[model samples]
Target: MDIKTASALHRLRLISVPEALSFPALLIFGSVLSRVSDIDFLMMPLGVLHGILFVIYGVMLLDVWVKAKWPFKKVLFFFVLSLIPFGGLYGDKVLKREEADSVVAARAREAAQA
Candidate 1:
């Protein structure tokens, strides 16, 4: 991949793990807080933040999917993976492997050209 595409992929990969992890955490915390306290102030901000992150993650997922021209099965797998708690970490691991392989391939190509 070119630098810009690679950068975009990297950025999405970074955000995906944290956002995916955070959303479920906030959901659980908000649910618990709602039961225990009347003040439940944290829910609003956490909800909004999680919602925004969810949207961003979806958009980034689509962007990377198209840019990478991944198979539909792979795309679907990643989409589904985002829904489960801690699944993004697994996704990140897969992406990291792909990134490393791509970099090595790019280097090999460059060396061949030189």
Candidate 2:
């Protein structure tokens, strides 16, 4: 992959995990808070933030899949993983492994070309 694509993929990989975790956290917290108090209005902003992050995560997932030439199964796995609480941490681990492999492969390709 080109440097720009690699950079974008790396960034997306980093951001996605936190964003994924944040969504569920906000939901659970908001639900509990609503039951305990009258600060239910908090959920509105949290919901919007979560929604935006979800869309960004989805888009970035597709972008990384295409740019990295990921298999459909792998792509689907991450997509589903994002939906589950704490699954993003697992996804991050997987992405780290993939990133390492990709870096090595890119260097090898460069050496071969040179």
Candidate 3:
């Protein structure tokens, strides 16, 4: 893949690790705090951030799905993985491996052409 494509995918892939983990943690914390006190205020920003990240993730998923032309099963796997805690970390690793392989293949093809 080209640098721009790789970079976009990587950014989304990396960001997902934290965002995925954060949502459940914040929700849990908010839920606990709500029982003790008010949490509507806290949830507002968190909800917005989650919404933005979700859109970014979905877009990146579509972008990479096309760029990589990944099988439907793999694409679905990444999407579902983003929802579970620590799953983003797993997805990042998988995507990184695929990206690396793509880069290597591109380089080899260029070398052959030269």
Q: Which stretches of candidate 2 lie over 4 Å from their true place?
A: 1-5
Can you tell me which runs of candidate 3 are displaced by over 4 Å? Answer: 1-5
Maximum-lDDT candidate:
2
Candidate lDDT scores, in order, read: 0.80, 0.81, 0.76
lDDT of 2 by residue, 5-35 (tens): 5665687788778777886788788878998
Give lDDT tens digits, candidate 3, residues 1-99.
655556667776767776677678776676677778965688767667777777888888888878766789988898888888768888888878776
Question: What TM-score, over all chains together, does every model reach?
Answer: 0.88, 0.89, 0.83
User: Which segments of candidate 1 are over 4 A away from where they belong?
Assistant: none
lDDT of 1 by residue, 1-114 (tens): 644456657877888888877867887888788889885888888889888887888898888777777789998898888888888889889878777766676677788889
Span of ten consecutive residues with least summed lDDT in model 1: 1-10
Considering every candidate listed, which one attains the maximal TM-score? 2
- Judged by whole-model lDDT over C-alpha atoms, candidate 2 comes out at 0.81
